[model samples]
Target: MTASKTLNVGDKAPDFHLPDAEGRMISLSDYRGVPVVVYFYPKDDTPGCTAEACAFRDQYEDFKQVGAEVIGISSDAPDRHARFAGKHRLPFVLLSDQDGAVRKAYGVAATFGILPGRVTFVIDRDGVIGHIFSSQFRATRHVSEAIDVLGRLA
Candidate 1:
Protein backbone atom coordinates (compact mmCIF):
# COMPACT_ATOMS: atom_id res chain seq x y z
CA MET A 1 0.00 0.00 0.00
CA THR A 2 1.22 3.49 -0.80
CA ALA A 3 1.96 5.66 2.18
CA SER A 4 -0.45 8.55 2.49
CA LYS A 5 1.02 11.93 3.20
CA THR A 6 0.14 13.21 6.65
CA LEU A 7 -2.35 16.03 6.44
CA ASN A 8 -2.12 19.16 8.57
CA VAL A 9 -4.09 22.15 9.63
CA GLY A 10 -5.06 24.40 6.71
CA ASP A 11 -4.90 21.50 4.27
CA LYS A 12 -7.96 20.82 2.20
CA ALA A 13 -9.94 17.98 3.71
CA PRO A 14 -10.05 15.12 1.26
CA ASP A 15 -13.48 14.33 -0.11
CA PHE A 16 -14.82 10.82 0.30
CA HIS A 17 -17.97 8.74 -0.05
CA LEU A 18 -18.67 5.72 2.14
CA PRO A 19 -21.60 3.64 3.24
CA ASP A 20 -23.30 4.53 6.50
CA ALA A 21 -24.75 2.06 8.96
CA GLU A 22 -27.78 1.59 6.77
CA GLY A 23 -25.82 0.94 3.58
CA ARG A 24 -26.62 4.40 2.23
CA MET A 25 -23.84 6.41 0.64
CA ILE A 26 -22.63 9.46 2.53
CA SER A 27 -20.15 11.91 1.13
CA LEU A 28 -17.96 14.49 2.73
CA SER A 29 -18.91 16.89 -0.01
CA ASP A 30 -22.51 16.45 0.97
CA TYR A 31 -21.78 18.48 4.10
CA ARG A 32 -20.34 21.43 2.25
CA GLY A 33 -21.05 24.77 3.92
CA VAL A 34 -21.30 22.93 7.21
CA PRO A 35 -18.52 22.12 9.63
CA VAL A 36 -17.84 18.41 10.13
CA VAL A 37 -16.01 16.33 12.67
CA VAL A 38 -14.58 13.15 11.18
CA TYR A 39 -13.18 10.60 13.60
CA PHE A 40 -11.29 7.43 12.71
CA TYR A 41 -11.38 4.51 15.07
CA PRO A 42 -10.07 0.93 15.10
CA LYS A 43 -13.24 -1.14 15.39
CA ASP A 44 -16.79 -1.21 16.59
CA ASP A 45 -17.85 -2.54 20.04
CA THR A 46 -14.28 -2.60 21.36
CA PRO A 47 -13.76 -0.75 24.63
CA GLY A 48 -11.73 2.15 23.36
CA CYS A 49 -13.79 2.52 20.23
CA THR A 50 -17.01 2.33 22.20
CA ALA A 51 -15.86 4.98 24.62
CA GLU A 52 -14.85 7.27 21.81
CA ALA A 53 -18.12 6.73 19.95
CA CYS A 54 -20.27 7.24 23.03
CA ALA A 55 -18.37 10.34 23.97
CA PHE A 56 -19.21 11.76 20.61
CA ARG A 57 -22.77 10.59 20.98
CA ASP A 58 -23.13 12.27 24.34
CA GLN A 59 -21.74 15.55 23.06
CA TYR A 60 -23.55 15.21 19.75
CA GLU A 61 -26.06 17.90 20.64
CA ASP A 62 -23.29 20.38 21.26
CA PHE A 63 -21.84 19.65 17.84
CA LYS A 64 -25.21 20.07 16.23
CA GLN A 65 -25.77 23.25 18.16
CA VAL A 66 -22.64 24.58 16.56
CA GLY A 67 -23.97 23.51 13.19
CA ALA A 68 -21.38 20.77 12.91
CA GLU A 69 -21.82 17.11 12.11
CA VAL A 70 -20.05 14.23 13.85
CA ILE A 71 -19.13 11.18 11.80
CA GLY A 72 -17.26 8.07 12.83
CA ILE A 73 -15.31 5.96 10.38
CA SER A 74 -13.99 2.44 10.74
CA SER A 75 -13.05 -0.52 8.59
CA ASP A 76 -15.91 -2.57 9.94
CA ALA A 77 -18.70 -3.65 7.62
CA PRO A 78 -22.02 -1.82 7.42
CA ASP A 79 -23.86 -4.52 9.31
CA ARG A 80 -21.46 -4.27 12.20
CA HIS A 81 -21.69 -0.52 12.18
CA ALA A 82 -25.45 -0.79 12.28
CA ARG A 83 -25.36 -3.08 15.28
CA PHE A 84 -22.84 -0.95 17.10
CA ALA A 85 -24.75 2.26 16.55
CA GLY A 86 -28.02 0.68 17.52
CA LYS A 87 -26.52 -0.83 20.64
CA HIS A 88 -25.07 2.45 21.82
CA ARG A 89 -27.80 4.70 20.55
CA LEU A 90 -25.27 6.84 18.78
CA PRO A 91 -26.80 10.06 17.51
CA PHE A 92 -24.25 10.68 14.78
CA VAL A 93 -23.31 8.85 11.64
CA LEU A 94 -21.07 5.82 11.65
CA LEU A 95 -19.43 5.17 8.31
CA SER A 96 -17.95 1.93 7.02
CA ASP A 97 -14.55 2.33 5.48
CA GLN A 98 -14.37 -1.30 4.47
CA ASP A 99 -11.13 -0.97 2.49
CA GLY A 100 -9.43 1.73 4.58
CA ALA A 101 -9.17 4.03 1.58
CA VAL A 102 -10.69 7.00 3.38
CA ARG A 103 -8.57 6.38 6.45
CA LYS A 104 -5.45 6.35 4.30
CA ALA A 105 -6.59 9.50 2.54
CA TYR A 106 -6.79 11.17 5.93
CA GLY A 107 -3.33 9.83 6.72
CA VAL A 108 -4.39 8.20 10.01
CA ALA A 109 -1.42 6.03 10.83
CA ALA A 110 -1.88 2.70 12.53
CA THR A 111 -0.74 2.62 16.13
CA PHE A 112 2.66 0.90 16.24
CA GLY A 113 1.82 -0.26 12.73
CA ILE A 114 -0.70 -2.65 14.24
CA LEU A 115 -3.99 -1.23 15.59
CA PRO A 116 -5.75 1.39 13.57
CA GLY A 117 -4.90 4.87 14.74
CA ARG A 118 -7.41 7.07 16.53
CA VAL A 119 -7.62 10.51 14.99
CA THR A 120 -10.08 13.33 14.75
CA PHE A 121 -10.28 16.07 12.14
CA VAL A 122 -12.34 19.21 12.26
CA ILE A 123 -13.20 20.62 8.86
CA ASP A 124 -14.60 24.07 8.44
CA ARG A 125 -17.63 24.87 6.43
CA ASP A 126 -15.38 25.65 3.49
CA GLY A 127 -13.88 22.16 3.70
CA VAL A 128 -10.49 23.21 5.02
CA ILE A 129 -9.07 21.22 7.86
CA GLY A 130 -8.87 23.45 10.92
CA HIS A 131 -7.61 21.06 13.56
CA ILE A 132 -6.39 17.48 13.97
CA PHE A 133 -6.05 15.40 17.14
CA SER A 134 -4.43 11.96 17.18
CA SER A 135 -4.23 9.72 20.23
CA GLN A 136 -4.13 5.97 20.18
CA PHE A 137 -5.21 5.54 23.81
CA ARG A 138 -7.10 8.62 24.93
CA ALA A 139 -10.34 8.07 23.09
CA THR A 140 -12.81 10.37 24.86
CA ARG A 141 -10.53 13.36 24.54
CA HIS A 142 -11.20 13.37 20.82
CA VAL A 143 -14.73 14.59 21.41
CA SER A 144 -13.70 17.44 23.68
CA GLU A 145 -10.89 18.49 21.38
CA ALA A 146 -13.17 18.61 18.38
CA ILE A 147 -15.80 20.51 20.34
CA ASP A 148 -13.24 23.01 21.59
CA VAL A 149 -12.07 23.65 18.07
CA LEU A 150 -15.60 24.00 16.79
CA GLY A 151 -16.36 26.46 19.54
CA ARG A 152 -13.45 28.56 18.38
CA LEU A 153 -14.53 28.27 14.77
CA ALA A 154 -17.85 29.82 15.69
Candidate 2:
Protein backbone atom coordinates (compact mmCIF):
# COMPACT_ATOMS: atom_id res chain seq x y z
CA MET A 1 0.00 0.00 0.00
CA THR A 2 1.52 3.27 -1.17
CA ALA A 3 0.80 6.41 0.79
CA SER A 4 1.85 8.80 -1.97
CA LYS A 5 -0.77 10.56 -4.01
CA THR A 6 -0.23 11.34 -7.67
CA LEU A 7 0.96 14.85 -6.97
CA ASN A 8 -0.04 17.17 -9.80
CA VAL A 9 1.38 20.42 -11.02
CA GLY A 10 0.02 23.45 -9.11
CA ASP A 11 -0.94 21.31 -6.15
CA LYS A 12 -0.05 22.50 -2.68
CA ALA A 13 3.27 20.98 -1.65
CA PRO A 14 2.95 18.77 1.37
CA ASP A 15 4.57 20.36 4.39
CA PHE A 16 7.34 18.54 6.21
CA HIS A 17 9.76 19.14 9.10
CA LEU A 18 12.76 16.87 8.94
CA PRO A 19 16.25 16.92 10.46
CA ASP A 20 19.25 17.93 8.43
CA ALA A 21 22.76 16.52 8.64
CA GLU A 22 23.69 18.69 11.59
CA GLY A 23 20.47 17.63 13.29
CA ARG A 24 18.87 20.97 12.62
CA MET A 25 15.17 20.84 11.88
CA ILE A 26 14.33 22.00 8.38
CA SER A 27 10.76 22.58 7.44
CA LEU A 28 9.11 23.08 4.08
CA SER A 29 7.07 25.95 5.49
CA ASP A 30 10.29 27.79 6.28
CA TYR A 31 10.98 28.17 2.57
CA ARG A 32 7.47 29.20 1.64
CA GLY A 33 8.37 32.45 -0.08
CA VAL A 34 11.15 30.94 -2.21
CA PRO A 35 11.19 28.42 -4.98
CA VAL A 36 12.24 24.98 -3.71
CA VAL A 37 13.58 21.92 -5.48
CA VAL A 38 12.94 18.78 -3.47
CA TYR A 39 14.46 15.58 -4.80
CA PHE A 40 14.17 12.04 -3.50
CA TYR A 41 16.89 9.46 -3.90
CA PRO A 42 17.59 5.94 -2.58
CA LYS A 43 20.77 6.00 -0.51
CA ASP A 44 23.52 8.28 0.71
CA ASP A 45 26.57 7.05 -1.33
CA THR A 46 26.14 5.53 -4.79
CA PRO A 47 27.17 6.18 -8.37
CA GLY A 48 23.94 7.57 -9.84
CA CYS A 49 23.03 9.27 -6.60
CA THR A 50 26.55 10.72 -6.40
CA ALA A 51 26.24 12.02 -9.95
CA GLU A 52 22.92 13.57 -9.12
CA ALA A 53 24.24 15.21 -5.95
CA CYS A 54 27.35 16.49 -7.67
CA ALA A 55 25.27 17.91 -10.47
CA PHE A 56 23.28 19.91 -7.98
CA ARG A 57 26.44 20.90 -6.16
CA ASP A 58 27.98 22.07 -9.40
CA GLN A 59 25.01 24.29 -10.16
CA TYR A 60 24.26 25.29 -6.59
CA GLU A 61 25.09 28.88 -7.35
CA ASP A 62 22.88 29.05 -10.44
CA PHE A 63 19.90 27.85 -8.45
CA LYS A 64 20.64 30.39 -5.76
CA GLN A 65 21.06 33.18 -8.27
CA VAL A 66 17.64 32.25 -9.57
CA GLY A 67 16.24 32.55 -6.03
CA ALA A 68 15.73 28.84 -5.44
CA GLU A 69 16.90 26.34 -2.84
CA VAL A 70 17.65 22.68 -3.51
CA ILE A 71 17.02 19.97 -0.94
CA GLY A 72 17.81 16.27 -1.22
CA ILE A 73 15.78 13.73 0.75
CA SER A 74 16.39 10.07 1.40
CA SER A 75 15.90 7.37 4.04
CA ASP A 76 19.54 7.57 5.09
CA ALA A 77 20.32 8.35 8.69
CA PRO A 78 21.76 11.67 9.78
CA ASP A 79 25.24 10.26 10.19
CA ARG A 80 25.26 8.86 6.67
CA HIS A 81 23.86 12.10 5.32
CA ALA A 82 26.55 14.05 7.14
CA ARG A 83 29.21 11.89 5.60
CA PHE A 84 27.73 12.19 2.13
CA ALA A 85 27.36 15.95 2.36
CA GLY A 86 30.91 16.42 3.61
CA LYS A 87 32.24 14.02 1.00
CA HIS A 88 30.56 15.92 -1.81
CA ARG A 89 30.66 19.40 -0.25
CA LEU A 90 26.98 19.74 -1.12
CA PRO A 91 25.79 23.26 -0.40
CA PHE A 92 22.14 22.27 -0.07
CA VAL A 93 20.43 20.57 2.78
CA LEU A 94 19.91 16.83 2.67
CA LEU A 95 17.01 15.78 4.87
CA SER A 96 17.09 12.52 6.75
CA ASP A 97 13.94 10.42 6.49
CA GLN A 98 15.07 7.54 8.65
CA ASP A 99 11.61 6.02 8.96
CA GLY A 100 10.58 6.82 5.41
CA ALA A 101 7.75 8.98 6.67
CA VAL A 102 8.55 11.80 4.27
CA ARG A 103 9.09 9.38 1.43
CA LYS A 104 5.74 7.73 1.98
CA ALA A 105 4.15 11.11 2.41
CA TYR A 106 5.45 12.11 -1.01
CA GLY A 107 4.46 8.69 -2.41
CA VAL A 108 7.92 7.78 -3.68
CA ALA A 109 8.68 5.24 -0.99
CA ALA A 110 9.04 1.87 -2.65
CA THR A 111 10.45 -1.55 -1.81
CA PHE A 112 11.61 -2.46 -5.29
CA GLY A 113 12.32 1.19 -5.67
CA ILE A 114 15.33 0.41 -3.51
CA LEU A 115 17.40 2.55 -5.86
CA PRO A 116 14.68 5.11 -5.45
CA GLY A 117 13.66 6.25 -8.88
CA ARG A 118 14.45 9.93 -9.20
CA VAL A 119 11.50 12.21 -8.49
CA THR A 120 11.94 15.94 -8.47
CA PHE A 121 9.31 18.44 -7.42
CA VAL A 122 9.65 22.09 -8.29
CA ILE A 123 7.58 24.23 -5.96
CA ASP A 124 6.78 27.88 -6.40
CA ARG A 125 7.25 30.66 -3.88
CA ASP A 126 3.70 30.31 -2.69
CA GLY A 127 4.37 26.72 -1.61
CA VAL A 128 2.55 25.29 -4.59
CA ILE A 129 4.12 22.56 -6.63
CA GLY A 130 4.87 23.78 -10.13
CA HIS A 131 6.32 20.69 -11.76
CA ILE A 132 7.18 17.06 -11.16
CA PHE A 133 10.01 15.22 -12.94
CA SER A 134 9.96 11.44 -12.70
CA SER A 135 12.97 10.01 -14.42
CA GLN A 136 16.21 8.37 -13.32
CA PHE A 137 18.37 8.93 -16.39
CA ARG A 138 17.51 12.60 -16.24
CA ALA A 139 18.06 12.86 -12.52
CA THR A 140 21.16 14.98 -13.00
CA ARG A 141 19.15 17.40 -15.10
CA HIS A 142 16.37 17.63 -12.57
CA VAL A 143 17.87 20.64 -10.87
CA SER A 144 18.41 22.52 -14.10
CA GLU A 145 14.92 21.70 -15.33
CA ALA A 146 13.47 22.74 -12.00
CA ILE A 147 15.28 26.06 -12.13
CA ASP A 148 13.97 26.60 -15.64
CA VAL A 149 10.42 25.76 -14.64
CA LEU A 150 10.60 27.92 -11.54
CA GLY A 151 12.17 30.73 -13.52
CA ARG A 152 9.24 30.72 -15.93
CA LEU A 153 6.80 30.62 -13.05
CA ALA A 154 8.56 33.50 -11.36
List model 1 lDDT by residue over 72-116, tens digit each.
999999999999999999989899998998999899999999999
Error of 2 at 130 (Å): 0.2
Write down the lDDT of every candidate, Cα atoms only. Answer: 0.94, 0.85
Residue pairs that clash (backbone atoms under 3 angstroms), model 1: none
Candidate 1 Cα RMSD (Å): 1.4
- Per-residue lDDT for 1-154 in model 2, tens only? 2367777887888889899999999999999899999999878788878999999999888888889999999988888999999999999999998887777777774546455657899988999888998777666888778778877876
Task: Choose the strongest candidate by TM-score.
Answer: 1
Error of 1 at 101 (Å): 0.7
lDDT of predicted model 1: 0.94
